[model samples]
Structures are given as structure tokens and as C-alpha cells.
Target: MDVIIARHCVAAGEDGLSPLQRDLIEHPARIRIAEAPTGAGKSYAFQRALRDRGHRILFIVPTRRLAQNLANGLSNDLQDAGWSRQKAAQSVAIWSSDQTAVLRSQGVASINGVRLLQMTDLGSFDGGMIVATPEVVSGLLIRRRVEAGQAGEGVFDMLEQFDHIVFDEFHSIEARGFGLAALFARLATVQLDNRVGFGVSRISFLSATPLDLKPTLVDIGIPEEAIALLRERIVPDGRPLHGDVRLSLVDSPSLYDLVLDHLNEVVEELAAGRQVVIVYNRLVDLEKDLPALSRKLPEAGIDPARVLVINSVRDSTAKGRHQGGFAIGRQRDPLAYDLILATASVEMGVTFRNADFMLMEPGFEAMSFLQRYGRAARRGANGRVIVRIEEQRKPWLRAVVDWVRERPGERSTIAALTQVLSRSVQAEFSPHNTASTFGQLSSQAKWCTALYWSVLLEHASNRQPRRGHLLAHQPKGAGAFYRLEQRVRQLADEPGLTEQVNHWLKLFHAQAFDLRTIEPKIRVVSDTGEAYDYPRVWLQRETEVFERGIETGDEIHIQGGLDDYWREDKDRHAKRDWICHFPHTTRTLRLPCDERLVNRWCDELEDIDPYEFDWEDHPQALEAVQKLVRLTGLVPGHDPEISLDAVSGVL
Candidate 1:
């Protein structure tokens, strides 16, 4: 199949307005869902619709980096529209965890002159723009509810103050099990019910590749008719908003090897003065292959300064090596670089207007795949995309490849392409699966809900008022909140358990109910005295390699010994231990800094029983045992023969 799709010259509409821009201006709805192609000006349209209306806008994105980018853009838009620079800066604020920390400590952190504000500041913030991640907004809502012991009236009032709430990249909401999508649905339902009069905030969801979210919204008690779904029409006679992307699919077992195979091609592109972007799925792979790429690029007479690396890692010391890698939150013009290497961090919200070619690993989901591709060929310049797929790992890529092949020489609009890719990964991208994932709360979400509701009930006393709010639409009685309430009550009775529960509650609330177990990270000092933090799990995996290197008398970049560093000062060790243990509640046991002790603790953590816990069967027992572990600082039963009942007395 030829990757190139024939382009046709088409004239823009007489009014030069996209369908979304026209709808926002002429036929505004309370709940609007817009699906448009990348660079179609969806965000700009939404901004323009709300501009001069004196409407308080809450623009929610998936990541903090995107929030920063959008906040900067919005501030600039306000300035371009005739607002003074200082006034525009003051109007556009960022509300994210990092910004929250800064605000709490220093009252403000400026991003491109825009003030970063706290959740408490929202009440007094008048008719301005606030950019945030869903986690930050949802966490604020949940935290307010638990703390105030009511229906979170303070947070709700703050939300009501916003004239419009826009969720950008809204497709990300369908993340499985207690994700922002599900949490937002519940929050939106509650807010809709609680709002009594006019001046309610309009909710708009914007996505380049949108999922069918109407069913999920309706399932969670949102009115079906209230939603206004607007899809961009593929105007055969109209010019494409984005550049025509020529895609090439490559199946390989190793993405690194595949990139190496195409090194000469990359060099050729760079030598031809074309901007190139290479995206890796894993940071480890990027780190490993970067040195080789750097060496070869310089040898090919390409200036080393032209190469730019962007990843999650922030290494100020590596400026001389990679021309100062672009870390998250650090602004740079990506188009300035002749060659770029990045991870998934650059996939969304970041655009490379002048990028002529791209070599990328296939993303896990279809949305991510499209998002990665969308980064290039922007600004109406034709670009080439080469996707390296590990078919054994991502078998869905084969289906997508076959689908494209079956329709050889076909010209597809962005909407049509989205449909084909989404269908290829139906289980993940389908509406049914999205609804199912949203309906079912994870155990951690259930635990948090039960705890919060129990606190709310303590103050409200009447259950009827609380009904139809807070995941009430789910089957089996308001998300089994009552069933889990007893467990929460029992655990609260345990000594110090209330404090522990509150700590965990705050942590989970801040994380937006995401309770994925994260490995403790420790800063490792390299032989060159450069320090970098690595997860304990990664270090554990590398231990064998380190030991084998030591036996063979080979020099290793990372020294296995860390006792000296830990022993340098007692306060240092204490602080490091606190940092490592802060994110966790009951997932692991705390141990001293001895290497042997760390290994033993890791083994013990692995050996602990999972309890086969179901929300319906053992809600009480699971909560009890989890609380017991937190209180006792010990796993209930390390031995397989011991029953959970045997540890009930410990609680």
C-alpha cells in the first residue's frame, strides 16, 4: 500500500469558520462535545467563544506540561486580543500539583508571566482562565468534600463560578478503573443535580480523536439530550487543516535495532537540512541509543548543537552532551532543532511545525498513535511518519496495517482514519468498554468513596439527600458505599488508624484516586558524581548486572555501594527514607538502609498474599487488613498457610 494519500486543492468556506467555531458562536449548548482534526483551531474557537463574555473558564488537560502550554497560549491569546500583558498574565492561572505546591509555599509561580493559583483562590478569581490537569481539579473536589464533611459546597461553588469548563483531549478520560473520565462523570452528575438556578457552567469536551462518551455520560445520570455532539465534516472540496501525513509502518522485534537500521536515512534527512523527530516509547531505550546517535551525527558533518533531546528526565549536568535536553515545563522552540529525540512526553499538546520526518514506536492505544503522529506535519506542511511496530507485543498494529493495505491508495480524512484505527483496537477504544470501565470503580476508588461517604454521613444524617450524587448511578446501590461504610467505621476505631486513614485519604485525593503501586525511588550517584534518581525496582533489576560486572572487573557507570552515602549523615538517610515512603501507605514494609535489608524487604513484599479481595465479598476484611498493615508496619501473613481470618484479631 502506498503511504502517500493524494491531496486535492479545496477552498475554505466563505465565512472561513470550522463547524466547531460556527457552533460555539451560533448554537452554544450546555454540554458540547467537539471532534475535529489536529490544528483545526478547536481550542482557539473555544477561547474565542468565551472571550469578551467575562466567563470564568476552567480548561482541563491530561498532563501538567500540557496545562502549562495551554495556559501560556491562552495568556498570549488574551494579550493578542488587546488585554494588557500584565492583566492577561494575571487572568490565566495554572492549577496543577507542582503549581499548587509553589502557590502554597510562595503564593505564586509565574509561567510565561501567568500566575499559578491554588484551589482556594478560585472563589475570588473573576472571569479568567484556569488551566489544570483533571487529577488536580478532581482531587481538589474530593479533598474539599472529605474535609468539609458536606457535599463539598465550597469546591462546588468554585466550580459554579466558572462559566465554562473545557476538557481538552477528552478522549483520555476513558482510562480504565477509577480514571479521570469516570471521576469527572460522577462529579459532573453531582454538580448538575446541585445547581439550582441559571448561570450554571457550560461543559465542553474537545478531542482530536473523540470516543462516543454520550453513553458513558448518560449511564452516569447525565441527560442524553443535554449533550451536543459536533463532529467535523470532511469537506472534500476544502483544504486540509493539517499537512498531508505520509505514513510508513515497520514491524520489528526491537525498536532500537530498527532505528539503528535507519540511521543512514536519518543522517541523510539531517544532511538535507530537514527537521527530524524520533520518538521512543521507553526512556531506557532513548538513553541507550542517544550516545550512538550523537557520535554518528557529528561524524556525518552535522553540527552536534542541532540535536535536541526531550524526555521526562531533567539532567542539568548533561548540557554539554545533548545540547541541554528539554525537560518537561522547560519551554523551547522544537522547530529550532534539526534532529529531535523524545519520549511519549512530546506526543500530546506539543507541536513541531517544521518537522519534515518522524520515526516513532507504536503507542499502546490508537489515540496515542494518532497523537504521536499529530506532532509532525502541522502548519499545512507535508510530513512523513515512519512507525516501528513490535507486532508480537502490539498485535493490533497488524490489523491496522492490514486495514490500510486493504484500502490501497485511499484518501482518508482525519475522522475516517480515527474510525479505522479505533476499530482495529475496539476492545480498548470502543464505547462499550469505555462505559464499562467508567461504571466499575477500582478497589482503591471504592475504599476512598466509602471513607468519604462515611464522613459525609456523619454530618448529613439523611441518606436521601446524598442519593443521586457520588456514583449513585452504578449498580448494586450507590457503588456499594454502605457495604464498605462498616469497614471504614471499624478501621476508624483502631488506634492511630484515623490519622493514617486521613493521610492516605489526602494522598489518594491528591492523586485523583489513582492507587497504582509506585516503586520507591532513590538517588544514585554515578562515578562522575552526577546524581540521578532511579526507582528501587529498576535498581533491583540491575543488581545482577552490577554484580556480574564486579566479578569480571568491568567498570560500571553506577556503583553498587550506597552505604557510604547513606551513612554520610543521619539526617540525610532519614530524609531519603521519608521521601521513599511518602507516596506509599500499605504496599511495602519500611526497612533500614542496609542493602541486604532492602533485598529481604523486597522479597517479603513479593511474598505477601493478595487476599483475593472482591468488593462484594470481603470489603470489610480487605479494609481491615490494609489498615492493620499500615498500623502494625507488618504484612498480615507472609506465610501462605495463614488465613486472613487468623489476622483479623490483629486489626
Candidate 2:
């Protein structure tokens, strides 16, 4: 059945390039958004179109696994384009922080002169197909320009070389990355302003769902016309390439219980020679559930050996091997495993052609729902998708589940969810606010901070000079240095930004100076003149308040430098260091009651027996009782301490 369905899917009629692909090949927009279905051959079409245009491609994705998949997919395309295996492998370059670190640790200069490209090594990213994470590419686009640095110039040079920069799986990017893509495009505008060249850098956002296109592009300074260029090319609906697939939404208190409730059915399906995949979004949950599920499967008459756990957090080399092995195992032997437990790391790009069932613990985010469910029924295989969610817990999630339940097609489901999300976001949006970004700090400053930290961490690890001036080494060639000099001159005209950057340089140099030493500590004081010390965290916004000394009215203090002082008495001239004396803890008095007015009051007493108490003359208790009597204005029926239940029984 699987082989027959696979053949039918391969032989399905819509085999040529999509309309969007033909449009891109004929008249590519400066910035284009392509919306297409998963199995519509978008990747192949985009690669071929860009190649025909004589443009080097730089494919950026959200995760490492997707990068690996694209690298392999593009390599096959290169081979099909009449390139040798060795040459094809050399043409595709992967730039990631992890891969670069591995290469550096082995004492190798570069993988064909492509250093990690994280730091100032943008030259290696000169030509050919470069696949990188959003972090790396975004960092390069907005790198700081300095008088003695050529990194900024290197960035422009690399930008000029690539005609098309595609962000695949655009919907999966977080706010930071999505914003960075916008910033990257905006910076390209500045790059174009100074270029004497004849080439223009184009951007393509390829996704199955480009939900918030207008708002995203507008936030990044892209004009409305550029956004109107979004071309949607999808497979026509109601085509029968595979058998009828079933998708059910299961609501349960928890994913664990959902699995147990269907344990017999799962066992029966596995026993019938069907492959099952249990998808988890959390690693901790997967680790806990995998063993429990494995242990319980035996009682249901399923072999434990047929169950396997695939984790993404293992060592990178081991992780790649395991992912590759899983893909191969699935393709070569469809029923090799009865149950496969995986995380959302495999939700995109990777194919599981033979899996007959998918049980997903849907993530909290609505955007990822489509990608997770799309894993099932690949290559037209008949399959079932059961999304187990705690419906009562998350209202927004329940709304999305209901939406998906109503729409069977992937595109329609995404569209409805997108509209729902847009309304939710728009209702909360304030038009009075001029700034698009909804925070105190500017977006530029945030990008600067991200770049600053990446450089700071890298410099500290490489043991490079911490001094900002000394950090800028000489460029390799004259052309890059010349461009760097010109860029520096242009930046020197803004005095306000120049002054702020000078302050930032001093701060960076000081931090670099402390890189080799134990970080300094700050002393804090409580209201009772108690002193406590803790190591200073560079970016800590809130002071740590800890309980010290005995439990007898514990004192809390604001921990900081000697400048933080407080005056206990306004009349006194001397001020006490608040870090040592002014504790932030609140103080309250405790009074113990010696007698209970009724038997029902005995349960509220602690560490003392209410029956044997005799404190008629207690001053604090007398005051409390007097206050209660005045407030209520109720006279005692018989004796003030007598139980009302006993009186009622007598009546």
C-alpha cells in the first residue's frame, strides 16, 4: 500500500514550476514574499530560478536541521545541473556558530576558507550558495563600523555578491530574528546608496504561511508596493494523490494521560505493522515520557526494542548522525520502529515518508501548529494526526484547535488562524504610539546589544584584546580597508551618536579588562546594618534580596554600592548605607490567642492547644476583642467565652 501511494504521489500531474516561480524567474521583485504549500517543490524551483539568473544564493533558516536539509537538497540540485560530487559539496557552505566552533577547535583554518564568519571573517562568505542561521547573517548586516575596522566593508562586499537572499520557513522565526531580517533589508538600502555597482540585492521570504507580511515589512521600512509583490503559488485543492487521511483533535487533561488512555489502540496499530510517532515540544517531558511509555508497552504486547528516542540536545556530531540515521531508517525500512519519540526539531524540512500515525503534544504557540501536523502523510501515505491538547487550560490554543478542526486543508487552516491572530494582536495595538516597536529601548539599540554580546563572548573565548581600539585589527587587503575608511568618515559626522558610542567603547574596554579576572562583588546592607556580598552580573536589572541571619524578623536589604544610602530619621544628619541598613522586607507583629471563643475556632490555632488555654488578662488579646466588639456592636448572649453550639443545644 505504501509503495503504491508513493508512486502515485510521485507521478501526480503538477510537476513543472509554479506560477510564483515563473514570475520570479521572469521579473523578480526587489523584495518578494512567496506563499506555497509544503510538497509543491518550492525549494527546487527557487534554487533553479536563482541559478538561471546568475545569482549566488544565501539561504537562511531558523534551525540547524533545516540548514542541513537545504544543504543536501541544493547539493542534489547542483549535481543534477551537471556538477561533480566533490564540486557540488564544495559549492554549498554552511555557516553556524556550532559548526564554526567545531572547525576552530580542530585547528583548521577554514572549510574551504569559510571560517565560522561569526566574528569579522566576512570575506570567506564571498560567493556561492551560503546557508546560515538568522543570527549569523543578521549580525554581519548590522556590524559596527570603526575607524580601523574593515568588518563593515566586508559585509557590504558580501552583500553585493549575493543577488538573492532567501529566508526559508519565514513563519518559524521569532520576533528578534524576524525584526533582524527587516533590519538586514533596511541596511541593504544604505548599502545601495553608496554602491557604484550595477547589482541589486533582492530578498525573498518563502514560507507555507506568510501571515503578517504588511505589518512586518512596514515595521522594517519596506514600502507598500514591495509588500504587494507577495506571490502565492500553491497546489490546487481537492487533488487526490494519497488516500483519505484522518486528523482528530483529542482533548485531555495531560499528554501523559492521553497516551495511556489510547495505549491499547497504539499497541493495536503497531501490532498491525504501522509506524507511530509521538511528538513532544519539551525535552524534559520527552525524557520522562519515553521510558514510561516504553515500560508500559510491554504489558500491551508490543516489543520494547521497536521503540526509539531521538533527542536534539546531544553532541552536534552525534545529533546529526542520529537525525540522518532516522531519515535513512524510515526510508529504507518503513516499519523498523513501532514507536518513535521526537521533539519539534524534526517538525520542518525533514521527511518521514512512511509514518502511519502522529500523536502531537501541540506547542503553546499557534504559528507552529501547521508545521508539526504537516509531518504526517508525507509522500501521499495514508496517515492519521491526533493533536492532544489541554483544551481548558489555554483558551487561545483551544480556539486554534477548533479552527483547524473545521478546516481540513493545511492552507485554509493557516489562513483562518492567521486572521484570528491578527485580530487578537490588532485589538491590543495602540495607534497613539508613534514607535512601531513596543518597548522603552529602540530596535537599533537592541540589535546593537545583540551584536555587542556576540562579539564580546567571542573575544573573551578567543582571548583577543578587550580594548575597543586595539580590537580592530588591520584588514587583509587594500580595497576592504579603503571602504572601511570611507564608512568610518561617514559615521563621524553625527556628534550625538559619536558621543554615545564613545561611552559605549569605554564600557566595552572596561568589561574586556575584567574578562581574565574573577568578577567583582557588590555589598548590600539590611535595615538592621547587616551586610551581604554577591558577585556582580553585568546585565542584572534587579538587586538580589536574600534572607540572612535568623528567622527572628528577617531583614531584607537592597544590595549595591556605597552610593545607595538612606536616612532612618529625617532629623539626623548622618545617612546610613541602604545596602547595609535599609532592608526592603516588610515588618508585622504576631499575637498569640490563649483562649478559643468556640470549639470551631480550635482548628485555626497552631503550635498550641486551645482547650487548656486560660489568658483572660492578656493585654493584646483584650485589645483585639474590644476592637471586634466595637466594630460588630453585638452584646454577649450569656458568657462571652461560651460556645454558641452548646447554647443552641440547650434551647
Candidate 3:
């Protein structure tokens, strides 16, 4: 079968398109769900199809590194399809925040016309390829809908222009991205149908672990036929043969000891002239452990320079060492360094083929475990994997680890693995009501949604759009839409939550609109409601107080007992009609101080700049601030920057 397919497509690898990719091209689906194990050449499947079909493609990935990797990989594929290397480079665009240096350092930017893209640049991105993080695309969709104008229309049109959009690492998508992707797929169906008088647009979701897209797409209002099409299009490929790969677990009381043992083993391997990849889940952990390990390596008779640490926060050197930005794969030459130290940033999509030895701090989820181990044994390389697990994770993660250890050479089908993971997560988090649980939402999704909705509510409140706005997409029902509306209302009605929401909104909008020149005063409000008087003038920075013998940052609860000190301060600082009741430490009682002070402290927190606020500066003042802020409601005023919005045409 492989030989037959390879005969058909001259450009395909010796193994040719996996049966999944082959089926996709032969019988295309409006919404395709394809599955293939890691190192099964998933990247080139769509790359080949789009290049041959001459279709514009939008490739969405989970991380900036993967974006860079896919951009370069696709460019090479384009060149292979008779495009000059320079022409291929010029035809592709990459969009991500603050990744220019990483791109240039990696030579992703050196290719002729490859440009760094932004939300605004989406309008002018008439290139053949687009590589971006799903988060960026989701934000653009939200911004376009809320801030409807020429800019909004431009984004809508740009999205509609894509012939195919591929979501790589589909299992990594959270609720918000999943919702947005499903939404875009629906819109593309309409736009493409209108343009060609039929459904020409194709949406493909590729993942090694299967996800049930029916519920998610249906939740987002995708049509029944589309959902059916997705089910039919699901091409679940068998796992690749991982030769000579052995999986073993190390258990120790202290994680430090576990890592130390692994390092000792790695040093021994390095001394034997074997290549190794050591992956850490946390960059901070790697930074802490690397220094200690490097100090010990000299005694072991191995050059410390042979160790390469790849993290986003490191500095870039000429040899691509200390390169702190997004690394698609092992930045340093695999042959050069006996070991490559990396964080989870390398886990998802990056390929480290030559390194046959892997020391991993096993991640909690099943997909992570698979992807991490999949890094080794690439392109027919035989490898071994060692997972160091802490005592705490032993109880829950042990079963999952055991599952992997039992199947070293054999790979489980995605559907089987998905079932295993679903059970594990359900047992841990939502045993009783697993069906109704808020489906696998990432922290980014929650934060982004909260911020986006706050911006929308604030803008809509000011503009006073028609009562039946597009926001109420669902008829009154107990479903995802109802939950979404409930969340929106909570943001709109609650003061403290609204302020927190606005805080996030302001940061994102600043990036979207380049807000350094604009004053944040309009949207930024004091959490304690005391940053301004009735006229809303910025207050003087209040210095926190620390008395002798008191810790510098203890939280002090104010009882509002009306002592002489309280009376004096109240008389002097309290504003008229501002004695709104804030809750006591216990919500059962009210603290009758000037609510503005507490509100301002909580909302804008003008009294203490969070980033600059020092716990050691004054413990008493820190406690005082927390007591004041905590004495009240769950949310704050979503102060809309009406003037700023009108001027910038974006909220």
C-alpha cells in the first residue's frame, strides 16, 4: 500500500502519505480530523497537499517554536514543489508576539520575504502560507467582533480568504481556541460556498490523541452535516514503530534526588559519547538544576560546554547556544552537545531525532507523556526513555506511567489512549459529573475570554447597541451559550471582577493598538475606589507604613471600630456620600469606611503597584491594603475608555 501511494505522489517520502493523509486528499471532508503518532510525518501531509493544490494555508500551532518550525518546514516543502527557496520564503508569513529575534537567530527571518506578522497585518497578509499561535487568531476574532469598524471588517475578510486552515497539535487546544476555530470553520464554509457556489474550504484538525470534536463543534453551532463530515473524515493512523525504546520510572522521596540521579546517568552516557535530551516541565527548574549539574560535570571529566540549555528566556550566542527564544528543536547541534536540556516548550511538535537517550520529568497528562517520549527515536532512530516521578505524583500518575512502560515498542491507537486519559482526568477532577464538566479549558482560554468579554461589555455599554445584539447568539437555553452569557453578565455586573477583567483587557488592547502613547487612566481604576475623588483625579501615591517589630508585609484586617485614630482619618480623608459599605473580613458584617479607598485599592491598586510593590517595604501597609481590598465585592467597575476607543476605532 505504501509503495502504491508513493508511486502516485512522486514528492511523498519513501513511506508516502500515511493512509490518513492519503484518504484526506482522495475524499476531502469539510471538517477533517486526522490522527497519526508523533514522528509519523504529520507536518508534511498538509504541506504537500496545499503546495500542490496552490491553496492559501493558515497553519495554527500551540507554541511559537512550533510556529517557527512549521514555517521553515513548509517553506522547504514549497521549494521542493518547484518554488525557489527565496520565493518559498517570501510566500510564507509568521505571526507571533516579540519573536523577531528568535526568528532571525534561527534563520526563519533570513528567508527573502518572510515577515513578522501582527493582528493588523492580517489584512495585508496575501501570502501563500501563514503560521501562527491559535491564541493570536482567537484574539483577533474577538477583537474584530467587539470593535466593529473597518479594522474589524478587514480581519473578517482576511480570515475568509484562506482556502485551508490546519490546526496542528489539536489536542492542545483549549475551550476558547476550540470554540474560535470551530466558529471560523463555520464562517469559512459560508464564505467559500458563496465564492465558488459550493463548499471549497477545508478545516483539518491533526492530533496524536483523539478528541471528540462533535460536542465542541456542536456547542459552537456548527451544522449537523459538518459534524458528520468530521466524524467521517477522522483518519486515525497507527502509532509508529519506536525501535529499541525502553520506558522506565524512577521514584524517590525527593524530586531533587531523582533529578540528581538522572543527571549522574546522563553524565555517564555523555562520557560514553552518546547523545541525550533532558527535558524539564518548568524552565525555572531547569535553570536551577543546570547550574548545579554544570558545576559537577567537570569533576565527572565531561566538558560543561557540551551541555546545551534551551529555553525562551536565555540569551542567544553565535553558535546558537544561550539562545533564549523559541527553539523549534535542539538549537545546538545534536552531535555537538552530548546532552540538550530543555523545558516543556520542546515537547509538543519539535523533533529531536538524533538523540536516542531521553531523561524526562514526566508530565501529568497522557498526551504530554507521549509527545515527550516521542522526541527520541525519530526518523527510525532507536532510543530509550527514563521518566523521573516525584513521590507526590506517584499515586495518580503511576498508572499512566505503567501503561507506557508496558507498551514500549507497540503504540496505542489514539481512540484507546483518549479513553484512558479521559478516565484518568475524570477520576481526578470530576468523577461524578464528568459529562457536564467544562471541557478541558486552558488557563489562557479563561483569562482571554474574561478579558475579551469585559472589553465587549464596556464598549457595548458606551455605544448602547441594539438590545438584541449578536452576543446573544443562542435562544434562552441551558447550554454553552447560556454559560457564556452568564459569564458576560457576571463581568458586566460585578465591580471587582469587572476591574480584573479590564486589567487584562487593557494589557491585550495595549498590544493590539500599541497603547504606550495612550494614557491608561481611563480604563485603569483604583481597586479600593480611593485612587480618585469625585472628579476622578489620580491620587498621590500612598506610602505603606511599617512600625517597629512588625513584619514588612503582613495582611492587617481593619475592623472599623471607630477609634480616635479611625475617626480622625475618616474625618480627614473620607469623601461625602462615599461611605458605601464594604464587607468585613467575614462577609456577614459590613465595614463602614469610605468604600472608595478600598475599591480603589482593589481595582486600580494605585496604592501599590503590583509589579513594584515590595513585601519587605512595609508589612503593616501590605496587610492594610489587602484588608481594605478584600472587604468588598467580587468585581469592580469596567471603566470604558470611550475617548480612547473612538480615537483608535478599537475598544
Candidate 4:
């Protein structure tokens, strides 16, 4: 059965602009948001709006690959629209810390013909477009704020240089602390309040799976009328943008088994010289399946050189061993490979030409599903997507499976599927909780921002010599910039203000900065003294359970000389290594929620009363607790007030 995933029909309004584009160009609000499905020309709309303004622009994306792609694309668009090649190349620049060393050595680097600029260059840059990730922006803001006096640049001074700042893939802001979304909220608040600032730049957020940011904005004191939201509406005469995509859902207990079952088809596609993309949810599953496929491919007369693998490891040295195929360290053209096996690394922003996709069910998020599906049948090419739905006991997964089973042969738009899943799966489990989660996350972000502002205020007052230790404290936050400014003044005269701030910084960093709770990765040393790091969670399973008894810094050996450890890193080191080696077969041990691990992880902050910390206000921190509980069972001897149930209720 074939299902047509339609794109929204966008008609041109005044000046040959779609309604969404027109609003983006003419809307009076200082802050604007555009919500449209993939391939609805959202990028083109923003490009036209920004081009007309001719303002110094800072375009922020979620990934380095995306920043590179957009920088090159923007340059081409400019040249095609009557600008000279030199002018177009000069107008667009990519700002990435990874390219810093290269830029310093060569003065400049080029990505697909667009210039890559050094971070310091931004201080002197007068105009044109600069593309960067959110982390770079946050780092710059923090560095400038901390070193204002000596650096001769304040946070406001840095921001005022840009006439417009656009955050692409704005949905990523829902991440815990100091994430892009929270930073946007804080900046929006500051701009709208007309605080002591100069050359205020308009901010825009673009996302296909847009969040309802209104509630979060209102909570931070922005008025409803001040924010403008432009959504792409379905038109009766609209046509599909990327032709039609045929979606087939297969019920399977294991995605690995499902892939093995379809090995013949995969080989047939490769033999016919058609591109194939298989997406796994974890590296462990990919590692297991690669060797099996590699062994069978030669028997089927397929060359091992046809398989390319990509994962989280971005080091060139780590990926150099895959001479038979290739790994994506520096960007390689996707068309060069006949078969590509990837994790979530390529799930967003990366485009592939005319490929058939096989994807493991990527949890309950509609955004993940939509993004992965968008990779295939791009432009006007028709495509097919085969999704392996593992049997799960969760209510949402059951509902999704039943829904797909019932909809056989019924054609539906991508937008319709998204809406249904958002309501059925996401809403059922945590509809209202999503906004609440972000609000709580934003508050923690606000506190971090407030701390940074307080430091700047202290230095500006000229009351005392600046403490170097205080400067070392990096503040991060999401909302309430005005309130944060107010707090800065209120704390100025207080004795021991620096000490109190430092104390809170330690606590916040412990709770918010720990990445293990979010992604639970482990490091392992191979039999040949090679080390590789990968996520501990099993990809074939549906839950968040992790393998137990594999403590960090444990040395183990692989049976057959690390034949295909694609993530092998010789020079790359970690403070601790987690597992002895990959188990011979899959293990079902749940990550024990032992109090010992929590204490060991956050030993320094154990003295502080968890009860006094207001866990209810910081949903991001609460989420960490929930994750800990989910991974390890309920912690033994844990403080009852801070138990999983308590934290879950707050969330």
C-alpha cells in the first residue's frame, strides 16, 4: 500500500511572496516564529526576507554540517540573485570552533566554496551573513560577558553588531540548560523590554515541528501581542513538494532481525546501483549488524567498498580504519556510497538524493520521524520508507502500531500523520508537560544568565577589583532577562555575594551539566589497545535500560582483534572508560539506580539540602532524576523527599 505524504501548498501573495514569507518580511514584531513542514520553502522565505533587508545576519543552526550546508547554499542563492561570485562568497561565512585552528593557520578555510571565518573575525566584521552553531554563540556571549573590561566588549556590544539573528531548527532549544531555545528566550526578553542596549536586532525562529513557545514567552513576561507566529496552512489545490513517499510499517520484535530478513532486497538494490540508507537508533546495533552484512555481501557478489558508516565520532583519526568503505569525519558526498549505515548523526538537516530508507522506530517523537523521512525522495523524486516497528509494551507505541496497521492503503499527508501522532502519542503521555518542562528548564537557564549579568554589573559599578575566580564561573539561562538584571542590582550590596554565587554555580552545574543521564555513553578499550566510546543503551530494545556491571575505566578484550570497531581512537582519551568490551551477545541488565553512583557523581554537592533546592521549579533537573530512575531502578537509601516518585510528580 502506498501513502502520499503531501507538503503544504504555499501560494504567493504580494511581491510574489508566500503568505508566510510576506509575514516574515513585513511583520512588525521584533521576535517572529515561522512553523512550516519540511520542503515548504521556509528557508527560501527567510533568505528572501533577509536579502531584502541587507542587514548583518547571524544564522544559527543545531549542527556543524547544517551550518556548512547553509553557508554554501546562501552564497549560491546570492550569486544566482544578481550578486557577483566574489560578493556572494564574501557575504557568507561559517563560524565554527572546529575550524578555528585551520582558520588561524591559513587565515581562512573554504567549505563548498564559502569562506570559513575565525571567531575573532566576528568582532571586526561589519556586515554580511555568519553561520554558527548555538554552542558557539553561547560560548562567545559567556566569554565576552566575563572578560568585558579587558576584552573591551560587553554582551550587548557583541549582540548589537547583528541586525538579525535566526535560529534554525528551533525545536532543539527544548534541551535542558543553556541550550539555544533558552538563550533565544532570554535575548528576546532583553530586546523587547528596551533595557539599556544599542542596535537591537530582530530574532526569528524556524522549525518544521514547532513548539508552542507562547506559554514559555508569556511566563517570562513577554506580552502575547509582541510575538508573531506564521504557520503554513494547507491549500485545497496544493501539490506535494517532494513528489510522493510510500511508507510501509513492518511489525517486528527486533529491528536487527528485520534488517537481516530484508538482506536480499538490500543486496538487490545495491546490485542495481541504487542508493540505500539504513538508520539505526544506536551504535551498538549498527556495530553488530555491520559484520554480519559484511560477511554476506561478498557471497552475494557485492563489494565491501560499497558500505559507508557514520556515527557520533567526528575525529578523522578515529574513522581512518574504514578504508574498505568510509566514515563521515570531514564531509564526504553521500552519493559516493551505495549503502550508508548511520545513527541519529544524519537524522537532521543532511540531505540525500533519491535513496530508499529503512529506519528503526525512533521513539515517540513526531519530529524525529518527520526529519528521518524527509531525508528520502527530496526534490521531485518519489521514494519509499520502510520503518521497523519493534513490539513495545508502552501505551504510545501500541497506539502507533495499531494506527499504522489500520491505515493500510489509506493515503495521508506527512502533516496529517504528525498531527495525529502529536495528539495520540505525545499528548497522551505528556501533552501539557512539554511546555511545563521547557518553562522549568528556562528558569534554570534564567538563573545562570542572572549570575553572569550580576558579574558584569559588579565590574561596571567600579566598587572593587574584579575577582578572577568569579570570572571563571560561567552562567547559562533561558528566560527573564529583565528580572535577571533586577536581581543583579539587588545582590550588589550583599556581603559574600561572590561566595553565594559560586556555591549555587557548583550545585547547578552538577544537576544540569551532567550528560550521562541524557545519553549514557561508555568508553571501552579493545584487545589491541585501541579505545572506542559508544552509547551504553541497547538499540534493539525500546526502553532506556543500560547494560550493568560495566564501570568506567574497566579494561576488556575483544575476541577477534577489533576487526570493525569503526570508532577506534588511538590518541583520543577519556577520564574514565566504561566497559570491558562488547558482550558476546546482548545483555538485559537494567542500570541499577544505586545511591552510590549518584553520590559518587555529585559528591561535592551532597552536603546541600536537596529539599531546599526547589526541584519543582527546575524540570530539567527533575528530568535528570527521572532518567536516573529509569536507567537504574529506584535508588536504595535515597532521600524519600527526592525519590523518583517525588521528582516524577514535579515533572
* Model number with the top lDDT: 1
Query: How would you encode candidate 3's per-residue C-alpha lDDT over 526-609 as one tens digit per residue?
Result: 223211111111110111111111222222222221010111121233222221211111011122224243455354443333
- Give the winner by TM-score: 1 or 3: 1
TM per candidate comes to: 0.69, 0.56, 0.59, 0.68
| lDDT minimum window of 10 residues, candidate 2 | 576-585
Best by the TM-score measure = 1
Name the weakest run of 10 consecutive residues (lDDT summed) in model 3. 1-10
lDDT string, candidate 2, 1-651, tens digits: 011112122222364555666655444456676665445455665567544444467778776656766777777777787877876666677776666676788887533234323222322332357778776664443332222233233333445666667788765654323444554454344323455222455777776544445454554344555543544432334332333356567777657777788777787677777777778876546644554665676778776656655544321232212211222221122234567777766666555536667788876554455566656665556666777766353554666555655554543332334445334333344443222112111232233323233333333222333223213321112133234223423332444335533332232222211111223334444454434333323112222232221212222354342223322222232111111000011111122222222221222221133343322323343333233222212112222222334332321
lDDT of 1 by residue, 195-312 (tens): 6223456677787766666655555445666678876665555655656777777777666677677778777877777778888887666765665666666676667677767765
Q: Give the lDDT ranking, best first.
A: 1, 4, 3, 2
Supply the global lDDT for candidate 1: 0.54
Better of 2 and 4 by TM-score: 4
* Model 2 TM-score, all chains together: 0.56
Give Cα distance to truth, residue 306, candidate 2, Å: 6.8
Please list the residue runs of candidate 3 whose C-alpha ends up more than 4 Å from where it truly belongs after superposition: 1-15, 23-27, 77-82, 99-127, 139-155, 176-179, 189-200, 228-241, 253-274, 298-306, 315-338, 394-396, 401-422, 426-650
Candidate 4's displacement at residue 439, Å, is 11
